[model samples]
Target: MSGALAVIGLGPGSPQTLTPEAAAALDRADALYGYGPYLDRVPAKSGQTRHASDNREEGSRAAAALRHAAQGAKVAMVSGGDPGVFAMAAAVCEQIDRGDAAWRSLDVSVVPGVTAMLAVAARVGAPLGHDFCAISLSDNLKPWGVVERRLDAAAGAGFVIALYNPISRARPWQLGKAFERLRQHLPASTPVVFGRAVGRPDEKIGIYSLDAVDPSAADMATLIIIGSPLTRVIERPGRSPLVYTPRFVEGGH
Candidate 1:
């Protein structure tokens, strides 16, 4: 009998943001596989076997989880944010497509949860209220030229861009370069939001103009939103500023 596998999203970093479906999936899992830090978010359950691996070992982790499920173990593959959004769901699907035939026969499901961009947008205002696209700055999988081209295209097309994997120790210069590319299309006064660790205790959110925004203020944990030309900011006397992109475009219905 083939067992089941669930690719689960843990939400941003707070238990409150975790969806009930994701929670139930976790409860049903007999074995869990994920990156070390992501695995640490789950409350320890007695008798549940936890398989932790490095963040860079997504393929190995997915394969291991599938192997266990093929042996009749109910497995859960965990990822921070929504599994389908640049997370483990794609990795798991890739493994099933290329791995052992038995892996294809096992039952597989993906449980969705809040992604980082959504959480960050909620903390301030709806920067994603208008048409938007997400792009990861990490060039590990794709060439850096591809990332730059996409950035230019997205900016020229007037879409609010949410940047993931903005910067890391190994990728210190990409975010700065991305900013330069965007500056070519967006105005100097375009709103830029730096939302770091949203839903976490040490969360920080800042708003700046594209010309004055500093790429060094960001890291891998940060989600950066570059507003479209139509995006706006409303200031209050003694409260945090509200930033949002209007839902309607002037010439569109």
Candidate 2:
């Protein structure tokens, strides 16, 4: 009596952003598994077993969900934002690859949702309108050297850079260091957008120059976008300025 495993993304803390597929999967599941904060975002379902755990316990939570799914329980593993983007989808897939051979035969699906970076990009106009790449500033799993190298490469390539997990209590100075690396290649007046807790009630958006940016403004909940040399801002009276990059590169066909 095997059951299905649905890896669903709740989007960036907004009910409106949640996809119908993810909503339907949540409604159909007999059990839900995720980080405590993400799991809390889901409405209480009658007779549904909720397995909430710490953010660091993704592998364990994924394994627990898989086990329940193997036992004929329809399980929905929820991830905030897109499940495939630095979230539980990878954790669940890793568990399936390393844990059990039988788990591969179980029905598993990844339901995509709007990612945090895109949500943030929308809130502050279209900073990522052109070519861009996303990089997590957290060095918990990987080394700082790797992050630095990637930042250097991205800056050198003149791509709009979306930074996730910019700052946390444990790894506080990484974001500042990353900015320093970018500042070498980009201009001092390069626009940087900080979208904190995007799509939430307490959301904050701060747009500032590369040199003037207050690194202290960012925290774990923030998503930072460092614009390219071609990015521009349009100021309007009594309105938040709109920041965007042109669709076509300068002197391009």
Judge candidate 2 against the unseen true structure and give its global Cα lDDT, from 0 to 1. 0.92
Best by lDDT: 1
lDDT of 2 at 120: 90
Worst 10 residues of 1 by lDDT: 195-204
Q: Flag regions of model 2 displaced more than 4 Å.
A: none
State residue 242's C-alpha deviation in candidate 1, in Å. Answer: 0.5
Estimate every model's Cα lDDT from 0 to 1.
0.94, 0.92
Among residues 3 or more apart in sequence or in different chains, the pairs in candidate 2 whose N, CA or C atoms overlap within 3 Å are none
Could you give candidate 1's per-residue lDDT for residues 1-253 as a string of tens digits? 6699999999999999999999999999999999998999999999999999998888999999999999999999999999999999999999999999988889999999899999989988999999999999999889999999999999999999999999999999999999998999999999999999888888999999999999999988999999999999999899999999999888987
